[model samples]
Target: MNLLRERLTTPGDPGALRAEEGERPQSHARAYQSLKMQVHQLLLSRIDLEAMENLSDDHLREELGLMVERLLAEENLVVNASERRNLVRDIQHEMLGLGPLEPLLADASVSDILVNGPQQVYVERRGRLERTDVSFVDDDHLMKIIDKIVSRVGRRVDESCPMADARLPDGSRVNVIIPPLALDGPVMSIRRFAAVPLTMANLIDFHTLTAEMAEVLSALARAEVNLLISGGTGSGKTTLLNILSGYIDHAERIVTIEDAAELQLQQPHVVRLETRPPNIEGRGEITQRALVRNALRMRPDRIILGEVRGAEALDMLQAMNTGHEGSMTTIHANSPRDALSRLENMLAMGGMNLPTKVARHQISSAIGVIIQANRLTDGRRKITSIQEITGMEGDVITLQEIFSFRQTGVAEDGRVQGYFQASGVRPRFQERLRSRGIHVADHLFDPGRRME
Candidate 1:
């Protein structure tokens, strides 16, 4: 967990800094610095703060504001009301919230907050990365805020264990890497999440997928066909998984296992499990594989693995082949073929010692659909391919793309303009859907049909 609590801002350009900070230091930045120093000095004075520790933010802010007012008045210093209010808010955040990140966290458009040490901060907005001016006062201040967050999640980050993964109060994913492994300074990456998770309708509106493609996916999911989503990092696999999970019958018990518990499945019978990292002594660690095995004993109608990255692939594949036909998970792969290869490698990591062809056969039989997603250059995520796994043919898993997103052209604004096209190859596994009382129209597989 992140646990550094100091921030220091160093202006890179000395001339610009001198110009920004004129003779009398009249800049708002200067005023904030001066006020911050005053607040720190007063805090160090050991003022009676025992009563304020458990107070609500509003009450605490009111009390802190009054204390600041008294200090400024005694010092015979005068300032603008706006500057004083800003200073008070900053102090409140420093004392009660994440120092410089509070504003970015509150911004709905910001999707990620990357703190590279204390001096440089970056944010992801609209799927594009941009550097932000928001930064901490020094490294200690930044470490303090990091400590505040990771500690809440019962994690620790120090010289002994310099890496930690945690979640925020709002379910945002957090990754912290500190020295001596981090090299430069403590590095913190926070993947921000929306207050309300995205739904299928939202994906359609965002053009992540066409209505026709969404319809096909909903049908397949409701039909209890085992599916795998393949995508690169930040390619919207988790969002797509969350949406498809909605198609499961709410009456059926669903168990979700994740490293950070980011999936927002909206079923009444949902059981969420999160992996546990080992403690300070390097013991009592619970991995995703153990959780997957335990989930089987819980009588789950469907099992959702957030993202299979290791030995857990074997158990998840077994779960799909067994009674849990509708089980779903995501994998880091560029295409359906790569997904299978990745699964094969992961299955080997399970210590099963199965032959290569045997693992390939299991992969062919377990997964029914591979939904490949891509994050385009223009910050749009598209389902580039939807392939179905037919049975193995001569030590190979046969895959046929039933739908593909073909980029017709790029718009003048650099936005990608693509349409989903039917591949004309119908899945050979329609009998699986039929067995579950589901039907698909023949025209859905027409070669000339444009699914958009």
Candidate 2:
């Protein structure tokens, strides 16, 4: 008689013979027989926890593997090895990072991954794009994935804190939102960068910029000119800024401030600072403005802001005007003009009673150039405009188009082909260049020819 039947009847298998007679063939009689033998063998092979404590992890794993193999054999089960292996992997992956998305995250070609809840996943691959069939089981499963992501970065996420901004080990930017705040259940956005960060020469090889453009930007960097990179979201502003900042001499002391530090500038003397969000108790927040003000006292030769979004605009502009010549920052805008306007509006966010005209004048004086980037219809990123800040002409800040992208025509492959050409009018900065006894080459500003 089986122990289960005997236990149900009386203690110590009392009615053993009668129980054996009663237990006949049933619908799952074979399953029961198979399960009983495996359990008996498992109990025989069991090691005490105290004994296992002295075993190395590898030894324990090997013993567990042997146990599972013996169990499978005793059951006379012909398991599909690949599917069963995948099943175990999937379970572990779901407990960690939602199985399917993990592969894409590991892929170097993938720059961004968008998972619309659980059903849809899209990836930006190479210069082109495509979608993949990957999903989470449900909202709970998605939340687990988010927790896994943030936990690796030493961040927290819960109802009290339904949002988080963090970075993966590879410096991939991660943002997560959950529940009522998200409205569409849990959401995650990961912006990935190349393992070996792209340099100026790398960008040139990718057709993102010409060698001549790189040279000009390098010269601007060496000249300690304040540059404002303007672009819509994901136009590679920070990437360009990182490459540009590499041109700064390692001797100069550099300070960088960011909401989330993303810039990877390769310089010896660099101080990176990040803004802090309010704590769970709704206190102890260090804002970008505070960082910028504090950066001023650090005796930095140049200040590089990751991006200007709020009251920090006032401090940044003041810094640029007061002996910080090469201070750089980025802003979200469609064009150079809009970026300047956004700066003015963000200055107002400081809650100071400064007039719009005053802010415009400050921007016109502080900023030297605006480098505009745009994501084209064909998914190509190009520097569409480079406008020199020619100071304020009355109430309007004048911007002269130093270099512009004139679309020569579309290629046979449906990609737009264009080259950055200089406007006929020379830059006003030539006078400043002449003052430094550095001649501005006439051919550098020439039109209708490929200089690079």
Candidate 3:
């Protein structure tokens, strides 16, 4: 222990240490990682786990900070105050949180964290991907962090499993794939949500949608119109779904089904159900389809599915058609028409064997609106199209455009230039909204009105 401490804290030229800027040299970084691991192991050896279980998170962090500072002082470490603080923080994170990910998770501006392997980490900030300097000591260190994350959520990943879907306590969605499947070492992606959920006003501020579109969507939610949000990955489908859910009646009983619970619905009377993966023995597996079927019996006024990806689509569609109006779910598709085709494919996956026409008819009847979200070439997420499912037209499901964002060109700065405009076709559901006393203005559907 003494030898390791001496090696880690050996004083270099005082001027050289003080002048260090930007990233540390490779040798210094390796030495720092070694020092952190030694301190982390020593701290684990000294702390009483049972006693720690009694401490609140804030208290535990404070106590750990003091202990780490004491250890550094005893070693006579020759690091600057900034380095000292970072070392203490890194040690604390190793003990109580996702080690190298703690800083990224704490950052409010980061929307996504992508870990390719031990040495490369990337983050999405403001819809742009940027590489980060954060990394793990090695593959083993990365695996430990992955284990900590999955174990907290009662999920597991290993050579046998090789994959897992989990979430942070803060509701950030986490996906993990390891070894045989990942090609590289364990790869994990975290889709982060805001500490405070984004509201419709926030979306409008971000130029994601217009105020008129927001009004129409709010009315759709209140009027119990089943909605399908279509988008590619990271195009803000879940965020928009959450904002729409805010418009749901507080008195109504809402049930949400998800593979992993990521929806932040703010209703007093709500039930959230998450699917369970098969255990090591390949028994006791619960799927979203089973949960959707079970949610039907709960007498929910509305059913909000996190995403429809498999056999669960049949049950979700049935729930919407029967009585659970205002139910919403998302799908991965580039356009509204493609979304319908995907829905049809998913219905087939359910093994109902309904003919093509019959399946199309079922979808046309159940879905009231399809809101297409897209991450444009310039990396801005916007609601590109909103189409109303206008029933069948001779074995085909017909759709009418209600509103859309037309991209004209990319600006010199590489920002996407677009205008959100109403398609001039007032929706058939406008009548339903009116019947429920939620009136949308006539001007909201006027084609002449364009918002940039």
Candidate 4:
């Protein structure tokens, strides 16, 4: 299609086999742009992107590559065999993969891929974001990429549905917001995870937690003590939840609920529930709270919510107390106390007009541990505080810090130096763990040596 539009248009320097238009660097770019736009338009008019996706990868690549070569030959474009193959792969990625953003997705270190507009792309690697040359040819090109993602997952995004949440093939979380709602042309953000989920040992290596803290959490999970992990946005809450949930007994049945199911729990007896958005007709919506209610009937030994947002907190707390112990959930908050506060607020959001005392009592009785995670300036995520919920004292829910990460000073290498030390206060549930046959070393709770 593009071959028809671009003429040989005055050849480049002698002996330059590349069909690129410009004699200088800038001219070569113009030629590439002209060539790419032609390919994009040609493929759209001749083939259905969705239909072609059904083909096997090898078949698709072979078929698409030949068509690109055929189109280029017709355009009288002159490129060596190597450039032709590269062009075909790029076109194939644009058609089958994420187009211009494909390379960024392939890079393991890139934790996030942010696109402000068609011409601007940024990626976060090693905790810092920097601009990259990757970009869409135009806004329409970007929308094509977004639509390709949403439609596959049975979602839609347009003027009518301008914003959407979707995940890529590799389980990378994706968000798409179009014009009118987006303000920019089309905004897309992708949050990628480690190819292999991090383990407690892995986190210990990263200094996210000490070996002793990890052991205590393992005992808490084994003891069936309900835990609520809290942190701000991008503070490693879900990652921590995934790591901690790994400690659940394999024989136990675990039910996990999420808006976009992202947990990769390895247990054999696990049932996963994902919330659904309202359909195009504004019907068939399933919410997290509804799922929590249904999970109780399914006989889940533990209910793990990806994140507790909104009215679901009430049901989750109720579920945790009603014979379903050791359940875990994540929430957005700054500290252990704030996590409780947010859970309370979410309980109110459920339209349960119970008194504050009643809600506090429910939280205090249901939750046994609060793990607060934080992302330091150097981009390391560490458990800042781990508090044990003793019970309600008056109208307040009493909590004692079991362990905390303290920043002694900055390191010479520019990395923030810190150590996770146990708090002298022993957890009230230590005896409970003992009853459940889960034990912790006594030295781990020595206040003078542990807390310091």
Candidate 1: regions farther than 4 A off: 1-31, 44-50, 409-412
lDDT score for candidate 1 against the true structure: 0.84
RMSD of each: 6.1, 8.4, 4.9, 4.6
lDDT of each: 0.84, 0.75, 0.89, 0.84
Give candidate 2 regions above 4 Å deviation.
Answer: 1-81, 84-99, 127-129, 152-154, 408-413, 431-440, 450-452
Question: What are the clashing pairs of model 4?
Answer: 2-38, 22-27
- Candidate 3 residue runs with Cα over 4 Å from true position: 1-26, 75-78
lDDT of 1 by residue, 125-226 (tens): 998899998877776778888899989978888888889888899889999999888777889999988999888899898888877778789989999889
Best prediction by lDDT:
3
- The runs of at least 3 residues in candidate 4 whose Cα sits more than 4 Å from the true structure, single-residue gaps closed, are 1-30, 43-55, 80-83, 411-414, 447-452
lDDT of 4 at 197: 90
Residue range 103-149, candidate 4, lDDT tens digits: 88889989999999898999988777899988777898899899898
Compute each candidate's TM-score over C-alphas: 0.89, 0.80, 0.93, 0.90
* Residue 169, model 3: Cα distance from true site in angstroms: 0.8
Tens digit per residue, CA lDDT, model 2, 365-407: 9999999988876777778888999988778999999787777
Displacement of the residue 191 alpha carbon in candidate 2, Å:
0.8
Residue 242 alpha-carbon offset, candidate 2, angstroms? 0.7
Q: Over the full model, what C-alpha lDDT does candidate 3 score relative to the true structure?
A: 0.89
What lDDT tens digits, residue by residue, belong to model 3 across residues 224-332? 9999999999999999999999999899999999998999989999999999999999999999999999999999999999999999999999988998899999999
Model 3 misses residue 313 by how many Å? 1.2
- The TM-score between candidate 3 and the true structure equals 0.93
